[model samples]
Target: MKSMRAMNVSQPRRIRIANGQGFWGDSVDAPVRLVEEGPLDYLTLDYLAEVTMSILQKQKRRDPARGYATDFVQLIDRILPSLRTKGIKVVANAGGVNPSACRQALVEVAEEHQARGLKIGTVTGDDILDRLEELIASGVGFENMDDGRPITDVLDRIVSANVYIDSFAIAEALARGADIVISGRTTDPGLVLSPLIAEYGWKQDQWSLLAAGTVGGHVVECGAQCTGGNFSRWWEVDGWDRLGYPVLEFAENGEFIVTKHDGTGGLVSVDTVSEQLLYEMGNPKAYLTPDCVVDFTSIQLAQDGKDRVRVSGIRGGEATGTFKVSIAYLEGYKATGQLTVSGPDAVAKAKVCADALWGRLERAGFTYEKTITELVGLDSCHGQIPGPPPDVHEVVLRVGVKDGDRAKVDRFGKELAPLVTSGPPGITGFAGGRPKATEVLGYWPSLIPKDRIVTHVDVEEVQ
Candidate 1:
């Protein structure tokens, strides 16, 4: 196979890339369907969430070979043959806390299919849990970005720490002839942007082009979200069950169109695409990434026919000298329990049930660091919206507690089952059994100088 770097300098008029996953728990069949349903040059999968590193770390602690997203491996197992046969490549951040383990799994999958001559790349050096103390000793404070607290406050409690790497590393993997690039803690947009960089031979100083790719990536990063899954106007969308994942038809000049396969479900219009563009958006004028800083205000969107939106005129600036770091630590323990309240005055009955549950816990010497009681249907969210709430037939009484004490959280769980028989009539819906206390992981976002972190890319061919 020809190396990605060795491809002709004269690029194609257009290339098609699609993202079939938004996060780790998104539909399992989406990526497989994306490969089989339509033509694509590259398929990207995003499996890491903000707190996903901690979860994968816990798994790694339990089993050495089990830190990556297993779902991705399964998906690859199902679609590897199609990907190779159709001349499609894959780029994904499903490596979680361990890209090496993920690459090993993929190699095994390739071997299982007796598939040879396939190159798999693993991007590493993002994880910094082991280097936290060393970095702190070297004057890297690792202060909490939100509150400006020093790392010494919870230094020992840190579980996972990873810096967000850039698309350049992924592009390098492709340049080395990697058919599939699995990365650790890559920025969501990097997955889509890397392909454009590799295909178009985009230069590092090309801020405008980089920004354009980043904006395009942000639009389709969440799979079908931009394709009408989370649109504001739900009544206009159709084919919910088979909604098409988003596709980016890219030009060498940094222009692109957001669309999906024909005959597939979902809508990809200006509104749907616009909704996704605003997702997780901070400042409309400046969106930061490892490669460049994008000006969202400069972006132009045009309706380019049915199920297609042309995106252009994106402007960007230089990236910061620092990289954002995601750290997770042991926060405490928390457990939540809910019960249904029916019949007349259901809202009143639900509120009463919440109070009773907390009162019982308080009386039992089970004080917590914090506690919350919510009449779910009434005001769990938005907290009692202005004006009178209409009468409801039923409401769910949900209560949760968080504390440093595990025993206290465990005892809180015991108090919920008693509510079914002891407090308020019409209490039910505990068929899944008692709620158990689970460890709460707290997020700590910080920044590290770009010079302090080094990314390594290793590509190995399947034997």
Candidate 2:
């Protein structure tokens, strides 16, 4: 408890940032607990994923005010009093696929107490959908990085093409009286960087200083993953229920102190921090971003006593000449069907059943690039003991495939139900409905020259 008490105090004007939640549906209790349990200057909530963008895009197509994160508004309603009372600010990308509606919803929540009229701010003008043609005319071809295809191939087919905007736009929103700042596609590090820029007034191109703070933001962006979620020495982390959420004590000299909530569910040991340090990181030195190229190799983490690791000695230089674009498109159709194979030659029968299904599909003039069949009692995610268990009560065989032909794919879904009554015994169909024929969205990550795109910062008052 002594170590816990040490983290619960104030640092006097130092910006303390606590990431209350990692993604949507992580833990509703976690954010409320972070607010009530600790003294936080700013709370950053990240609720986004590749699939989330697709979901939100669908919502936007239906209603203009329905695309944003409404759950954030409801959660904010519960915490408005606490935030207003403690003078705590908030920055979150729960705007998911829409930032404007998010800001408006927050203003409505603030009207309950009339808390200075709740000056909500939105940072937009980053979206480039309307200007893609102009960008191409200017010789900016956003070639598909994965398939080497040009942007023209799927130009109209593209649903969402957003550049990961930097923190300056968000920081500008904060500087101009935003109680809560909501954004659409700002980078994860930008969430943390915006708070510091707003609080400390750092210049845009102060590369060294900006790089250092960006490093701090990147370190703690993934919630407990940075603290101890995937530590190498998993058994060593104690008291996971109270494992701490990351804390950033910002300094004006381009440095910050990284700690956590006093009594949270994780640990921040050097090993835990290190494990997160390498997760999906490409280059140690010259790590690229929209703002600066940070050098992770230059970072130094000292166990500045229990539960606190002080990081310093980071260096950085010029950013890359281009911005990476995240584009999603229709890939193909995928179907997964599961059934049990048991009785005598259960395993062999399961294989035969799979082959028969494929054979029938082929005879029906349907084809796919790949077909996968796995016996659940044998695969790792579901397998146990590795041997036949008792009487082999059931051996579930899961089958899946991906194909470009939609008609053929639809035919495959119709085949699953028949197998229950026709082929192998005990072939219980989990659900009665046919498998879906939804479009498969694939990520197309590529870069465009920085000179071609102009990122602007705009802030507007709520109605």
Candidate 3:
């Protein structure tokens, strides 16, 4: 930890940070637009989801150098020249389960772009899948945070286990002159929070500043969410075609303004920012992070201007000694098949089709551990409410099955197409072939002692 005396710079230096991506499949053009459309000091991207690690782990098993987000490499190829010209830094968690592989890909992209003197930092050590047995022997239980089950129960089926690391390693990478930082399994807020820690030289004990930065990170972490993409009042928001991603104007006093680029789309009011604040939040009083536990209830929001909201009055407490661990395992196999049922009695015909499919499967001695049948137009979203089936022109009959036996699930797929010919009238939409059984991955959340995890940062310069 570097002391404030070593910083030796003027106080109250503000920076502009914008988030271009919210998740793995976010718009590919948003990141490039964020860089080219406006002035930005830092660009943060997030690419991992809870089940993303398992998917990436499977990819790495097939190919040694293929686990990270490939989109990030291509995005960098498009934006490297602008980033270098603008003197802008980038921080992202596109590393997935393979930071080294991601680093290599980024190096290749940089070389292809002919970008020189760029320091790419690779942050590692969040992965603990190989150390599970050793940690268990050393008295780490890895108990399920939800059901309190021991991890030994599913040890053989476990595919990925990563701890949610903090932002300090990223800050260290920046301090070491890294122009871009790549990390694995970092908390989404840490992507933005790390740059604040690095640029402001905030100490670990500054809970208020850390909490403020964490809130700032959370607001823009989802990209357009704070800028009215998923706001409850969608009708109130304008410019859906060109919605601007969220940007933060962070200051040294632990206050930041959330806004979008002038003349760009998307609305950034208190309501939109408030809606994003509660997204996936558990406890308002103690929003836990690796750096500190924030008091979200103590925070205040006000409209600073059009498409701008000011956030202030945040308080925080000390961080817990344990870090949350995301563990994914192979649950079983699942397959789904759907058919569009139309005409006089679409709902009734769909129901009959579902019943016939199940009866045929039972007669063939193909029983599954679980099965679901839904009439897409009727009750797929909010499971069948108390009401007569709405009279509709057409309804899609979707059926799925999950079981430990792959053969059974595959056989279940074979049953759906037969329904179109034999079950009910006016059944179509089977153009897409039978659904093949796919691996079903389950998530297990756990906790690990913070001391058990040690993160490393390596900064390499492009020649």
Candidate 4:
């Protein structure tokens, strides 16, 4: 048994982590390809973002089990046979707003693959919404990190409040006979890190070791971000459509080989890995998490071969008591439209374009918290951001405003479509049936004590 699992008895072995899904709407083919393509000990998918929590919360309110990523359950049913055949485990934050419900859904999927039963695990307790009042009364001010105001200032408008938990809980679930681990609002890197811990049985205080694993997780958590999907030099990348999903071939000693599936597309150049290293990273020297503070610079990525990069040499530090806070508020609805100006004086034509649209709206009694009009293809970007004004070929007259009045927003939406038929000749990219009015959900930030919440792990049979 030990010989078959060389990683278990010795100096540790490479454990591969494949990030199949980048965000909620990413391709299902990604994960399917990853599993069929190579040997992966753990498969990871991260589906939650700050604003995503609000969206999921709204769905949960409508139906108890409906909020979690339904696609994940569907994906499970498709991949369960492949998973058992390959002996590959999966970890994901697709539980979104409801971990227990997602767990239940996975068990149903497992039951369908009756040849081999599957044990699904869920990690809860990050949510702190119900404890808001008691936490505030205890002199713990969960103030808005941005505005510094107390929680009461926007008490009624709050939607979802969850802490970014460490990956150790995920590791624990895997240790406790769980074939799959589902969670809500875990750190993006946690999905990857937990698998490393589960495979190696790393203790909690293995700070330097855990930090190294965390760095690897960050690299692959966004699917193709490190795999050349979002690279700025898209031209430089060889094959994007077949671009390989990322994999972290982890080792028990906190080192790993960073590579993609063999014979798959995508390049693992040093520059590509470097770009992913910088995403959502605050302090490279101290990339803080509930697990440990990761020192990204100490890490090194060496090109081992084609589609393979060796990742090693990371350091770690202590973690802070507080976790990152995510809060949201109501931003109301906004409507925006753009028109191209392409006459002799395109800039002048652009301003004329703006005036004509707003002139009528103003006459119709339209006022909002803000109104903006800009010319694209010319001076849209960096427009009075730091300074202003660059004269060029054509300007796109972009106008937008937000207000409590839904009618005003509806009117603005109606105004954009007419501009295409009546305004400039070069307008495009608007294939959708007209830009409909949509309400934008705002975000808020605050903190809660670690003890204020508790995480529960539950398992059940599928009906």
> Distance (Å) between predicted and true CA of 137, model 3?
1.7
lDDT of 1 by residue, 51-158 (tens): 788999999999989889999999999998999899999999988888888888998999999889999988998999888888888999889999999888888898
Among all windows of 10 consecutive residues in model 2, the one with the lowest summed lDDT is: 454-463
Residue-wise lDDT of candidate 4 within 1-463, one digit each (tens)? 7786785656456777899998888888899899998888889988888888888888998988776888888888888889989988889998987888887777766776783557677898777766667777888787888889777777787788788887878888888877788999889888988887887887778888889888888898788888777888878887777989898888777877778887788878788898899998786888888889988889888888887788788888877777776766666787786655665677776676577778877788776777888777765675455545555776667788887777778777776666566665655444455455777777777666666656777644333
Candidate 3, 1-463: lDDT as tens digits: 3667456454456689999999999999999989988889999999999889999988999999998999999999899999999999999999999999999999999998888888999999998888999999999998899999988889999999999998999999999999999999999999988999999998999999999999999998889999989888899889898999988999988899999887678899999999999999998999999999999998899998799899999998898999999999999999998999997899999999988999988999988899999989988999878988678999999899999999999999888888878977899999778899999998999999899999999999998
- Per-candidate local distance difference test: 0.90, 0.76, 0.92, 0.79
Model 2: lDDT of residue 401 = 75
The C-alpha local distance difference test score for the whole of candidate 4 amounts to 0.79
Q: What TM-score, computed on C-alpha atoms, does each candidate reach? A: 0.96, 0.88, 0.96, 0.90
The number of the candidate with the highest lDDT is 3
lDDT of 2 by residue, 152-235 (tens): 787767777777777888898889878788888778887888888888887877877778878877877788887777787778
Sorted on TM-score, highest at the top, how do the candidates line up?
Answer: 1, 3, 4, 2
Clashing pairs for model 1 are: none
